[model samples]
Target chain A: MKAACVENGLVLVRELPDPEPGKGQALVRTHSCGLCASDAHFISGGQNVIDLSRKMGGPYAALHYERAFVPGHEFVGEVLDYGPDSRRSVKTGRRVTSVPIMRQGGTHAVVGFSHECPGGCGELMLLDEDFLLEIPEGLPDDHAAMIEPLAVGLEHARRGRPEKGDAALVLGCGAIGLGVIAGLAMMGVGPIVAADFYADRRDLALKAGAHIAIDPRETDPYGPLPDFGGRRVNLIYENVGVPGMLQRIVEAAPFDGRIVMGGYCMEQEALFVFAAQNKRLNIQFAGGEEPQDMDLALRSIADGRLDVTPWLGGRVGLGGVADAIANLSGPGTPVRTVVDPRLL
Target chain B: MKAACVENGLVLVRELPDPEPGKGQALVRTHSCGLCASDAHFISGGQNVIDLSRKMGGPYAALHYERAFVPGHEFVGEVLDYGPDSRRSVKTGRRVTSVPIMRQGGTHAVVGFSHECPGGCGELMLLDEDFLLEIPEGLPDDHAAMIEPLAVGLEHARRGRPEKGDAALVLGCGAIGLGVIAGLAMMGVGPIVAADFYADRRDLALKAGAHIAIDPRETDPYGPLPDFGGRRVNLIYENVGVPGMLQRIVEAAPFDGRIVMGGYCMEQEALFVFAAQNKRLNIQFAGGEEPQDMDLALRSIADGRLDVTPWLGGRVGLGGVADAIANLSGPGTPVRTVVDPRLL
Candidate 1:
């Protein structure tokens, strides 16, 4: 089976032994796998993703994403075979995506970040049957690849609890930001304001349903009320985990606002605590989504309410993943770039 | 009538004409009034209480707190007379405490902060009958005066949603902090740890039901988990509102901790937002409480489950309020200073 393997600091496609299905697991043939920022983090040299995972001090502490680990978690695949003692949740050849949790020595290890099991960045991978969810009809392979990321957005939007007519500000135009916009749009939350540094990402945000997209370089988002059309932002989604973005959004929130933080900031960032205290805001941190959230994301995409194909910058095969990751790391890179393992 | 008035940055009891009950209002003889920090803010006069109120922008924007207004909001009194068109919620001579919102020419005004109606800092005060809550039989006068502040703590505790086995941390030992301790005690949340800069305040916190009281000046509160007895802090109540206090608490909190910010910080303060984001914390700011919360506070006090009498530093007459506020503002002062208008 062809898989993208990391050697030293570079990722390249190589023929690896096919992963076998363990108990309560199913063998899956990969369809489409999305390249994520975390994948870039693992591939880059300075900081090791496995060491950071251990530093987080969770079940991840014992788990390992070793030097040669496969890199993708957001991927769609088909059930190929079931292991002994499996529940047989789905038939062979069923189109599916799954929550990637592997039990290791009485603890759970996240699939893509675990060294014991290869992730969907390969032609063949093994997944827990209980974590599987069938992709619905009318959703393409590109959009199906987005089910995991979109579920992240849905979970964050659920945490914010945005109501109709409440003004919202999303302070990033990355993949997570686009997913949040799609979730908010499905919920009928209006007048969504989005901010981004890049014009292309800003356009993608608008396509995802942002009413107004501001390039922060040109305008002052923290100037005053008139900057946001005199409307008090009751809900804020901070997708930019940078230093000043959270502080700026907190300044624009009104009394009793809700701020959902979805961005993964690897470094410590400073914010004005007094500002958040004054508004009496509810600040919630969003990490990942539950199974129900994944179901909702798939349903919304199948119903045509969420269209993320525009977010897909390009498609590649396992052999092209390395270049795609390199290109995506540069400035003016596309929102999402995917790889199909079956392609030559 | 004797009333305490703020004139040119001084609060002294002065003889004034007896105030009469207006339409839909009642005249009450004050029993006990608590000296709050806002009173000090009003007397110091960098910004007047009304300006701050208006800046908050609610009913206070249209309501006026004239320069000579009396300053006490947490008080218990007996109804002396009823004005025309007053609803017969309680009879004359009924022991009650009101929420203190009075409509003045189509706009509502807060009682202690409103110039139009004298507060309980005086011998007599005008209260809207609609704002009144009858004191239960078993609750004493001093404890009844705490109903409002206790309600604040109850609201914050409710927002934090601490279960039975959850370890809690309180970051201040002020009057509000003691009230929060009492609320947490009533909810049966154990191993409550409290920190205070003042030794006297720490003593009061322990008396109020904190299992452990740490003087923050003697030890580094943010050092490591062993400093807090190697227990995870799942719930934190931030009542200090000072610079670096909230940040330290966020650092000490365990995974998915709930932090309730109850104190009001007047200036901007810096915090580590990444620490909070990584923990996936739910940070809620507690302001005013609901009617149900107020009822719960009173009920908790009436049933002898929550007692805050130890938090009272000392008692003073109307004329002594100025010196009391000044002394309480300084170090080595008691937690709460109450004023009994009947005393000389």
Candidate 2:
């Protein structure tokens, strides 16, 4: 099996023995896998200290990711075979997208992020039955590959609980931000304002149903921008995790505003506690989506309410995973670059 | 009539003209009014910059309260007489607890906080019909005086949405914290752990139905403390709005914990956003409670589900308002020091 593994802080395409599924698991042949910014973070060793500390359970300091781990979670694959002692019958050749967690020793461990478990970045991977969700027959493989990131966006929007005709602001134009914009659009939340440093991503945000896009470098994020004739933003989706953004969001939110924080920032940041208190803000810190979010994402996309076609930049192979990770951070990077294991 | 007003940063009791209620208003004779920390904050000139900026609509800076503002909101009173042309059939001499807002020039203004509207710190006050809630017959005057703060606690706990048998933590043992403890007890959330620097407040918290109380000064708030044989805390009511408490709360919260911050801190605080993200915390910043919360609070007290008897200290006259404000900040402060306008 051909696999893309993080070996000693380097992303390498290595040939490895095929992994067999355990009881109540299925062997999935990778079809289409999307490259996430977190994958780049893991590959480039820029995982946030606090997130790493909690995920890996160590001291409150920078965490060094252990070497030799497969790194792709957002993927659509087909089940090739079920493992021995499997009780239920899930048909072979069923296309699916799944949560990246595998049950290990009565605990859940992320598939690709954990070195012990191989993920769908490889030619063949194991999927636990509990975490697997069948991709609908009508949904294409490319759109199915987006269920994970789209689910993340849906989860953030769900937590924000936007009402119809509520003003919203997306503070990042990355793939996740684009997904959030799409989700907000589906919910009929209008006058969506998106801000990003990059023009390309901002343009993509417009296609994802943002009513207005702003370059924060040119205009003050808190200062006067396109208001869409609304009083203030009701919900703020902060996807760019860095110091000072939360304060900026606090300055822009109206009274009783909801802020869904999905960004992954490495550094400790100062919060405007007094200001947030006066505004009576509800700042929810969100991470990955639950299984239901993924299912809803797929359903929304299949129903034509969500479109990920604009977000798909191009597809690559296992050999190109290294370049994809590097270029995704560069200027004028594509919104999303997927990988096909067969191309290796 | 007599009133205690903030005159040149001093709480002074002075004779004033008895107010004549206007259309749709009722003249209420004050009975029992509780002294809140916010009253102290207003009297002692500790308004935060954000609150000040929004209130005054100017640059971000600490706001100074103008002299001659009354300082009380938590109060129970009796409707002495109706204003001219008032259509309300509400019985005269009926005891009630009303919202602390007065309609002035077609806009509602906080009664005690606004210099133009006199509050319950006076012998008699004019009440707006829209803001009045009749007190049930069985409830005592002292407990009815607590309806406002108790409502705030109910609002925070309502936002937290704790299930039955969830481990909870209340970080402050002040009036608001004690109210949250009472609310949580009414909700049947158990093994409630409360922390405070003062032993008296801790004892009061235990009386308020806290299963356990810890002195954070002696024991590390983040380290191992008495857990009452329960798992990590699922909900944290943060009434102590200091710099490091948020980080400590993040460290102690279980995954997907809900933190309701009802504290009012004037200082700029640093929040561990990344740590909160890793824990997927739902942090809700609460302000004053709504009318529904107040209604629920009164019902809870009337049904004997909540008790504010431990929170009430000895009553004081209007002449002692200054001393109560000063001593409330001192060591060995009473749980709650209420004022009886008739005592003047």
**Candidate whose TM-score is highest:** 2
True contacts kept of 2: 0.65
Residue B40 in candidate 1, Cα distance off native in Å: 4.3
Each prediction's TM-score versus the true structure: 0.67, 0.73
lDDT accuracy of residue A249 in candidate 2: 78
Provide all candidates' interface root-mean-square deviations.
Answer: 4.5, 3.2
Kindly report the docking quality category of candidate 2: acceptable
Worst 10 residues of 2 chain A by lDDT: A55-64
DockQ computed for model 1 against the true two-chain complex using alpha carbons: 0.25
RMSD of 1: 7.5
User: Per-residue CA lDDT of candidate 1, range B29-121, in tens?
Assistant: 999988877567545442432344454444445433335777788888888998988786788787888775677775667677766777778
The pairs that clash in candidate 1 are none
Q: Write the per-residue lDDT of candidate 2 for residues A92-136, one digit (tens) a residue.
A: 898988877777664566776765567768888888887789888
> What does candidate 2's lDDT look like per residue over B1-344, in tens digits?
89887775788999988888888888889998888877765444345552646653422232245547666888889999988888665688899887776775644666666655577788888888777899988788888998888887877777677897568888888878888888788788887888898888889889888988888778644343455542556788998755676766776677788888887665667765767776788888876688888888888778777767877776899998888887775457776788988897
Instruction: Give the lDDT of residue A207 in candidate 2.
Output: 84
